[model samples]
Target: FSYCAKDLGLVLLAEIDEAEIFKPIAQLKNQIIVISIIISSIFVGIAFYVSRTISRPITKLRNAVDRISKGDYNYKVDIKSSDEIGHLGHQFDEMRKSVLETNRNLNMLVKERTKELTDMTNALDATAIVMVTNRDGRITKINQKFIEISKFTEKELIGKNPCIVKSGYHRTEFFEKMWKTISHGEIFEGEIKNKAKDGTYYWVKTTIVPFLDENRQPKQYIAIQNDITDLKNIEYALQEALKRDKESAEIIKRHVEELKRTNIELRRKDKLKDEFLSMTSHELKTPLTPIIGWCGALKTPRILGDLAPQQRAAVETIESNAVKLEKMISDMLDAQKLDLNEMKFTIGEVQVDLLFNKIKKDFEPLLKEKDIQFIIRAETADIRLESDEARILQVISALLYNSIDFVPKTGGRIEVTAESRDNNIIFCIKDNGPGIPKDKQEFLFKKFYQVDTSLTRKHGGTGLGLAISKGIVTRLGGTIWVETEEGKGSNFYFSLPRKY
Candidate 1:
């Protein structure tokens, strides 16, 4: 500093102002401090933004984990960013879907297996003489059929040895063979003769199975048996029948001619009965026609309009009875025709709705008298069908008439419907009446089968309506059946092909 000062100035006294000297230095220092503060602020803002973006998805993932850990496989994270967090969420959803699918599959498998087990159990319970025993051959479980056939009480059979029913016929070796086969996890099948508690003999075709555990050692035994006593009796009878065949040969030869004569007589009698029925039907219908026509004419306003109600009631009663008699005669005639295979039909296209309307009109008065609610429902508008309109309409009318006899005295409901199916038209007649019993339902369409036959029976019908209807339906390439339960109601259904 002394050499440089000597060169720069003659008197290097260092004359300087303290205020101006540090001015630029102080400005630079302030600028550096301001720059540092700005940089720090920018970094702080970036850190806050990064934390917000990163922590939000992490927080959501944590919540999802909590829910999933609580067995909520349906919970999902909503991370949509194109980052590792989004990938994790996607993987998590896939895992959850797999878990749910597994759960559903397991549940379905359980249901299916349980249903199969139940069905198998029910089948075994019904058809077989089922019995279960432990490895020691003590009776553990037995079905009602077993108890019934053995004539042993449940108390006597439980924990009892199966030898209680041992018949002396089978040798001890036979049973030893059976035990040997079954104990070794093999099946033993044979004819078994067991003594009942009453000391009577019964035969059974038996199959004994040894139920094995995972180690392949028998844990228990299951015995299924079928009562073959009848078969055995039949076999014994057949043996006796063979021995008697020679003796019966001469007797059979002697009776053959007589049987032939009897058969011819029977045939002649049947023919005569049919002829008489035809003639009787014709005779009855001829006279009844005039009675019905005249009574109907009298019922009109122009004929007997001024008659008192009670007087008119008598006339109407005669008319109704005559009509029913006519129906019975017609039914007899139809049955005769069917027996002779002469029931003919003029098949043609017919309007079903028109037929229904006509039937409704025919039964309208009777229905109104009975106070029955009658409805005809045509699901297919202006329903046209290719069939014998006359016969089909007769069936409808007969069903309606039959329902009239069965429906309640008042407020009974009868609904008739025709629905057009893909290939056929279904006709249904539903009646709110005392339904047919289950035992009688099978015979409903049989000839001369009536549900009520007591002297005080309120319903009146020839019992030929359903039988004739069934025949007509069969001829028309259709089927008919009734759905009913006692104390409920009856639904009669008939299906006819669209082209018939």
Candidate 2:
């Protein structure tokens, strides 16, 4: 606010008390409060009137609109006030009733007209194999076509399992997967081989679709099958005839091919020989362990306490050879199981530091004997992972053994390191050894393969250690590979997902 004073020219202005000018309003404070309260009450009354006359009826009509959109013509607004909105509500209810009546008659007409088409489809069911099996795999219904194909009477099939027609052609896992898929309301389509009542197998291109209930769970399975036995037989006959025609043309070249084929057969036989040796080693070690154990007991200080120097030495020799045999037998079994994918994993969380410490102790004697430098670097304190601990140990030990065999005898260096890689742990074993050549690296993981096959090869092995290591690593959801040049050190790296 600006103020102007009409004093003597530029003379000092006087102070003024403005409270007196507003004294009337201050004295009428109660009256002002009363007027404010009356204004608020009036506004409240109008808002209440608008809500009942406008918002309420509109809300009911909006709900009715929603019901109509969802195909529920039976919904109506029940507003009964004597106002324009109430009149509109009554008119809306009349329209809804009219539409509901019309819709009911229309739906009845549709079903009646389509009944003939549905019957025609039912009549055609006799031409195709239609069988219904409940979720439990029990036959619930089988049409004439199904009975004709299976050679079973409707009475015999009504409550029996669908496995009555199984030909034993597929594995148990196949059926397990089929049930798992259909039980989740998915369709399973495949070429199925079935056995007839006469013990003859037939082929059918089959599709089983699940019928789902309101909860989306399969209530039953509808199996529609098309007989493909004749087609399959024709395909087999054509393949055989083509094979014969090719064989006739290759008669002159057969001798050269025979030589190559013979080499393959020889290699196959060599594989069998290794497997036999592995089996034989297992048998030999079973008895040898008991023999070695008894010999040791005889020379012990407490059990059979007394022994001559030569006797004690002989007993030690037996024990030493027994340990070697045991190691060989274990390697054989591991190789066999790994090659056939027969190894099972008992997965659990493994503390990396504890595992590495145990491995260090196991290899301490070997390191001292060879005068080799063994280093273990576990980078993190809380490093743990989910895996088969025994298999993981086996793979690491195999890598260490390979290093021990090939690394320089005087100044060999082997380093085992583990560190976290994002959500996984990377394990690496590096060795300063006679490095492998590029040509030999590719075949290093093949069963019974070796870089050197000569009798006097410096590094002695059955040539299955790395292959078994690779197999174990792969099965544990990890990849193993050796990085080496012709003269540099080799680094074997594998990674396992870390659970913690």
Candidate 3:
């Protein structure tokens, strides 16, 4: 029984030992589960903390990059970490600053360029020149002055060739030369006559320059010009005026030479005229002396008593011819004296009626011989005037004699009338004779001008009667002229100042 009890106790002790060992294993397992739960919780907390720190800043940085890409430089990433993310933030800020600064400078540069272009345009406008042409010689740009000068707008000139402004004044070769010069990257300066849009012509001093491209080829052209129409016109007018002045000067010089030649010829003719007058006077007087002497001697009874009828007729003819010759001599002397300006006048008050009666009686015998009817009409009786008595009588006698000589033999009549008008006494002699021709009237009072050259020979008298009468009347402060129409009679009138 002791051995059996001892076996039980050993078995119980082994079971207890096993239970104890199993209990410790169970506790160890429980402890292991708790430790795993704690470690998992700690690891989860650390993961959440790391994810929040990294993800939040990374998300902010991502948003900043998005804003920057969209040209928004104002956005910045806030990363407080002391790692690469902070360095990246700094770099991002710096990049944003640089981009902003670059943008600002670009905007400023654009503004400055815009202002410079505006200033250049304004300067071109003031200068009245601005033009741009394309590669094909078409106009592309035109300024305000170009519009004003051409009478065209920018739209009109654009796409139009420069030939559209041609005035046709220049040859085609001229434009060809200009094109050749400008197309070779050369500048051309010349005057061009161009037509405006209104079809009027204008002169322009032009400078054409070629616009070159990167390859040095002519891509476009610019033409600057100024209107010189008025200046050119003034120069042309001056040249024309100078040419006319030169022509006029040549003509005047020729006329001056001609006048000098004419004066020389006139001087020689004047000398010849004086010599002819002296010779004519001497020849006329030489015949008058002997005839007058014989007529006076034959009138004496002691030389010849009771002449026969035929002899008496001869003596009367001789006496009458001698008297006519004596009168002609007196007229020639008077003409010479008047021509030399040596004729003297006796100014005094004269009885005009008495003078007229004496002249009428003196011409009565000649009128009787010619069978001419004479009538005297007076406006007033004894109208005295201030004049030379003998000179006045001489003028009246000469005029009466001319009237009798020209009076037609078939129907001859003379009428003498006197009147006082204004401050003058006018005496008129009207004769029924062949009237003077229109063209012959101006020379009627000229010395040696005979209306009827045949009448001078038939009447046996010099043609100096009316000439001497004109001179005497002129000296007496009077004027004489004839009024007549063709186929009508002549009226010779004289006016003497009454108060002279």
Candidate 4:
């Protein structure tokens, strides 16, 4: 019984020890299960918290970002946590605020720019002349200037055809060309004359531009015009005046030509008169020459007896009258020949010394009668010059006669000088007579033009000697001129070219 009881006690003790070990192990397992359950619950709570905090805010941010991508700048995220997830939410919230602010500023800038553009457009519309038209060739919009000029109000012009103010001044061709140009979307500029509402004509320089639509078709035409009626009127008046002035000038020219014809006829009549006088003088001289020759024969000792003093005086008078009559005939003939250009010249070389000697001898008698001294000074004794000898002699004779007539009987003198200058022989005849007047010098060599007509009558000349001399000198390829001052002596010069 003791052994059995001891065995039962050992078994009990082993069972109790096993129970203790199993209980502790089971308690450890239970504690482990409880701890795992608490940890899993905590993890689930953390996951829920993270999901609510991070995932929810992130999702909200993603939605806001999506909205922003679709141009919705008004989206926002609500993330107000304080952990790491909260921090992420805070960052997303800050990003949303920054994006929203940027969007707000951008919108404000766009609004400002849009407002500015709107103001500019409104200002341009108000200040500039704007006209719009529909595609139907009708007046739609007109500016203030157009309304003022057209004598039509905006209400009167709108919806009205442009032909309402056409004025009917332009022809159909004008409108045809205008239509053709504008229909092709071209711009045309021209001046147009139109009748105003008051029935008065006016002008406008106009420019028409065609507006095109998207299909490249002409949609409307805009015409801008300014008034130029006054300028047109002024130009028209000027053109008319110019036409009248041109007509008057033509008439005056015709009258002047008629007067010139009449003057030419008068000159012909004068020439006929000169020719008649010359013929008459010659006719009278033919008979007088014979009479004078018979008188000379009567004075000869072999033919006439001694005469008394009174007879001698009468014969002398007849002789003197005959000489005067012969001089008048010669002067008339010379004047006629000079006027008709019928006088001929015999050109030849004449020694200067011989010419001077002949002139001195010929004038010696006249010089002695006037009690005046005549001088000849030659630079070269053998100087020979080409000239019409007889004509030159006649010129010299006439000059001597003029000097004798003009010079004072007591103190005046005449000088003849010849010299070689510039391949020509120059001869000068100077006299201490009263010089010609300034106004008369230009006409000194003109036909029938004399310094003193009374002097011409008293001195007995045809008033053509100097003119003939000038013609002769010009024909000989030489020149003749005179230099004189009032109250100073006159020097007459002539030059003849030297032979090579």
| Residue-level lDDT tens digits of model 4 in 1-500 | 12236655653223235686688889999999999999999999999987887788778767866887897756655667677765765676687778889989999999999999999857745654445667778888887866656676788889987776677878999989987888888888888886545566667887888889999898888876777879999999999998879988899899999999999999998988887887898898888887788778767777878777788778878988988778767766876776677878787888888888898888888798888888887987788877777877887777777778877778979998999897898888899988888888889788777777773455556677677778777767788899988788788887878752
TM-score of each: 0.51, 0.45, 0.48, 0.51
Please give the distance, in angstroms, between residue 243's alpha carbon in candidate 4 and its true position after superposition: 9.6
Query: For residues 36-67, could you state the per-residue lDDT of candidate 3 as single tens digits?
Result: 99999999999898787777778888999999
Once superposed on the true structure, which residue ranges of model 3 sit more than 4 Å away at CA?
A: 1-262, 265-269, 279-283, 308-315, 454-461
Q: Model 2 segments beyond 4 Å from truth?
A: 1-247, 250-281, 303-313
Report the lDDT of model 3 for residue 395: 81
Clashing pairs in 1: 386-500
Cα lDDT of all candidates, in order?
0.88, 0.86, 0.85, 0.79
Highest lDDT, which number? Answer: 1
Clashing pairs in 3: none
Residues forming the 10-long window of minimal summed lDDT in candidate 2? 1-10
Instruction: List the RMSD of every prediction in angstroms.
Output: 19.5, 28.1, 25.5, 17.8
Candidate 1 regions with alpha-carbon error over 4 angstroms = 1-245, 297-310
